[model samples]
Target: MFPQSTQSPPTSLQVHPVPFLANTQDADELGAGSVEVPSWQIPDLVVECPKRPGARIHKGTSLILPEAGGDLLACIVRSLPVLLQIRPRWILGYSMAVDGVSLRTMYRQLEHSGPCVMIVEDSSNCIFGAFLSEGLRPVSQCYGTHECFVFRTPRLAGAWRTEVYGRSVAPTSPSQIEGASVPKPESEGASPPAGFSGQKAKYFEALRKAQAPSSSASVFCNHMGIVVGTDGPALFIDQDLLRGASWPSVGFGSPSLCTAGTDFVVRNIEARQNRFGIGAPNANERPVK
Candidate 1:
């Protein structure tokens, strides 16, 4: 989970521009008094990199790949939308770690050698982190092929307000809590009583009925799924169901062949009822079509 806080920036990385936006707010109502951003008040879980202890992969931290290898840049690019949604004051940028990726070598080549310069500019779409600099000059003439990338996040304003504004006049059920995933105990040790064996005279007779899901398809919140395969003519599927359903639920873009498996989420969609031909990841679900 990505953590959110205005406490301070990461020390190892450098965040420039000292962002104009403050607090998490949608494009709209973000700067009006104070914007309401998505759930960024809670910080991401602290990743304990047992292999790389020195590296603290915390939320809002910059991560530099040794080089532009695999899908590192693409993974980083996805965060831009999240940042715009969160609208944090700043974002830290990291230097690619050596001996980690081939991308690190690319950075070195660009930083030192060559006659690289800006040749064209697609100014129509103002994307985030899209900057072309020569000796730190972000002008149109300062960009070129493979020399730079559009990295600046597009700035949106007034995009989150709804047509219906005022609070509901009628009371609503306390069913859904907006930002609470942690559950509370109903009573002291409110779980099943602990014991492997029972005393004599305790008549043990239990009967339970077994049945399949009420429907051919079942939808679960935060349900896990696996990539059965690409959606092309020649598709491939995975045996391991996916863990991050949200990542794919939006839509599967140009999936890359990388160290990490490609993921796609089908909403209100199940592996069974295989008429759609979607494959299930395990014995519980159906096979790929």
Candidate 2:
């Protein structure tokens, strides 16, 4: 049975700006080369890593993303909300290798109320993660905003693709959600109105389905561990932080983060927080509300 939380859920949604944007100047400078740099390779704008004699990898200092699989992290960053386009200093919040394999340790290390990026590398070498609106902790009810998203970098060789899935925002008006207008009632058995037909009808149907309301329970954290979606959670990490499962979810509408079916063995996991200001609390220090 899944463990539950005793703490009451927050009454209202708490939205926060996530620092994931890259400065245009930095992006231009980093992209200078004979070959154009992929969107995933956009260097971290906040850090100034000294150029090594023959370093081929381009990344920020103190980043937990590995050189070989850093593309996954980049993809997640690129898929963040527009307001969080600028990248900020990323401080390591937790690592299975350094902090031990306990969910409690991860919660303790990420006590601050700030945005975080959690990356998980499964045994099959599949890389995926979530752009969390807040740090990980055990909470009573569902939390997070539409800004939260889950992403996965396909492991296909010679292919650079990142699939990102996020919560669908409900439209306030009918016009906001585009779909073919319903035909007026036909006179008894009169010739059915020639509305959309063939491919056009299919297109409108697909569009309407895509705009349908999704589950609001984007995230649920309790004593058991973390679940990313309420309707068949897209991702679930156990309290031991050793095993996990992933599948398509209605909350984010994301496919399995790992290609190897629904279950996966955790290989390595890390959480990184983007520092806001000099006065901002570090991973070890809980922010003063």
Per-candidate clashes, comma-separated: 39, 5
Q: lDDT for model 2, on a 0 to 1 scale?
A: 0.54
Model 2, 99-179: lDDT tens digits are 557888778767763788888878887777788886677876567777788876545433434457777554445543322
**Candidate 2 Cα outliers beyond 4 Å, as residue runs:** 1-64, 68-70, 169-214, 277-289
TM-score of 2: 0.59
Taken over the whole model, the C-alpha lDDT of each candidate is: 0.19, 0.54
Query: Residue 147 deviation, candidate 1, in Å?
Result: 35
Which lDDT tens digits does candidate 1 get at residues 1-289? 2334578734321121222222254532323242222233212212122222344333442222211121222222222333222222211111222112222322332332222111111122111122121212112221222222222222122232111001112112222210111112234233211221131001110100010111101111111111111111011111221111111110111112111222222111111010111232222221111
The residue ranges of model 1 lying beyond 4 angstroms of the native Cα positions read 1-41, 45-48, 56-99, 102-289
Work out the TM-score per prediction: 0.18, 0.59
